[model samples]
Target: MRKYWFKVEGLMFKERPFCYLKFRHFIMIVVLGCFLLTNGELSSVIEIEARIPQKNDLFSNGKMDSYDSLENRKLLLFIIDFNDFMCLSCLDSFLDFYYCLPSDFQKHLSWGILVFNISEKEGNNNISARIVEKKLRGFVAANNIKFPILIDKFHVFNGLAEEGTVVMVFDWNRKMVKRYVFPLNKGQIEEIFKFLTE
Candidate 1:
């Protein structure tokens, strides 16, 4: 190791040969550390086998009905819509990804929206089931969302809370392949697309 001495304000200080390089490296490391520290945990694509939620008849064509009889069938792609209405960022992220999906690709999938924090009326007040159903219909119609919106009253298995939304990808046999929280990154979207195609 080599040392260089420099004087400033009548005081002598010693620095390594590549002091500037070392400083730059230190700053880079610190910036990376801060980025990771602040960004909380990000859900990664994972492989897992699981069963599809059996609770059904929660939604249909923008209407909430009793847990009426529902036929069970193999599902290719299903989104567990555990989206809180207040979490606009998460909902926006999911909508962007969903709307951009290819038309043909969209048809081959079944969809559902699970409302965790229900706010059908103003001032964040709780509303009746009929009112909620009407609001859900208006929301879907207003946003052109072509999917069933299910309330999470039964607490059907979901991974997101009021802070964010979880986007899950499941196979035909009802096994969850990946579950990513929004806002989803490019890599996550790509991974989901690959799974959907394959």
Candidate 2:
């Protein structure tokens, strides 16, 4: 009878390390799921899939090469909202990818960036069209950016001068194929380049 009681207590009350770990992970996943659903804006920014254009025979055309105009060339438009480039984690991702871009591919892509600023209760002109471009050049040079990061003082998302930036990738076909919202890992950049190269 004592053995039976001891077994019951051990099984019922003892902390199992594996089980505890599993329970903690489950709780985290649930909390993350709840957070993603509750906060619509952050959730949208957290994960995004861009629209990829369908490949056609014209994809092999010479218009995709280095000789093409910057506007006609494939473009990677990265819109950045953070005013301070040094302290931002997103800046790290941008620098990593910018440096990783192969020379041959870099010339043809014609990368451009639009820097934006968030506003307080001010009436208008939250982000000076001039300041935004200047900040962009600083980041581009500091990070050894080989591509041009154009300034968009007016944050044109939907409404005029909307905040936050989105990364847009244009294919050789002169179509805006994809827009990357969140910062990406190295593998993601590789895949994007690979898609364009092919």
- lDDT by residue (tens digit), candidate 2, 111-157: 45454555655435534554554555566556656544445444544
Worst 10 residues of 1 by lDDT: 41-50
Candidate 2 lDDT for residue 78: 63
Give the local distance difference test score of model 2: 0.54
Best by lDDT: 2
Which segments of candidate 1 are over 4 A away from where they belong?
Answer: 1-83, 104-108, 118-131, 158-163, 172-176
Candidate 1 lDDT over residue span 39-154, tens digit each: 73322221121234333422344354442332222222334343444455547877788787765334324455454444455444334434545555655666676544455443
Per-structure clash totals for the candidates: 1, 1
